[model samples]
Target: MKATVDPGRCQGHARCWDISPEVFDLDEEGHGTVLVAEVPAEHEEAALRAAQNCPERAITVA
Candidate 1:
């Protein structure tokens, strides 16, 4: 799966990073940023978990 973050919807909750630091990067403001355009197979689970953990639903996985 591939994941992306909607910057407009993200707050500074940091739950995405807390759940999957390897797949999501936090900006200086602590909002999540997608680490890659597409998630690698090995990291898909973590990416999905991060997406689900986002309270703002700022993360999308496909």
Candidate 2:
């Protein structure tokens, strides 16, 4: 799976990072950011969870 974060929609919630630090990271401003180009199988579930948990709905996983 692949994950991405829309900078325009992100509200610096950092929820994605809290849920899936392996798949998501935080920028200097604390907004969610995808750390990997492709999410590993072990981290896909967490990635999806992070996407769903994002208050701003700025995360995307596929």
Candidate 3:
């Protein structure tokens, strides 16, 4: 799976980070950032959960 976070849509809620720290990170402003260009197989489920739980819906997983 692949995951990405849209800076423009992120609200810094950190839910993505909370859900999947291995795949997502927080910027200086506390917004969501993708830590990896490609999501790790072991973290795919967590990444998808993070995307689904993101209140801003800024996360994209494919």
Q: lDDT (CA) for every model shown?
A: 0.86, 0.91, 0.93
What is the C-alpha lDDT profile of model 2 across 1-62, one tens digit per residue? 79999999999988898999998888888887888999999999999999999888899899
Off by over 4 Å in 2: none
Winner by TM-score between candidate 2 and candidate 1: 2
- Superposed on all Cα atoms, the candidates' RMSDs to the truth, in angstroms, are 1.0, 0.6, 0.6
TM-score of each: 0.89, 0.96, 0.96
Candidates 2 and 3 compared by lDDT, better number: 3
For 1-62, candidate 1 gives per-residue lDDT tens digits of: 78889999999798888888778898988878988877889888988888888888999999
Ordered by lDDT, highest first, the candidates read: 3, 2, 1
Per-residue C-alpha lDDT of model 3 across residues 1-62, encoded as one tens digit per residue: 78988889999999999999999999899999999988989999999999999998999999
User: Looking at model 3, which ten-residue stretch has the lowest summed lDDT?
Assistant: 1-10
TM-score of 2: 0.96
Q: How many clashing residue pairs appear in each of the predictions shown?
A: 0, 0, 0
Identify the superior model by TM-score, candidate 1 or candidate 3: 3
Model 3 TM-score?
Answer: 0.96
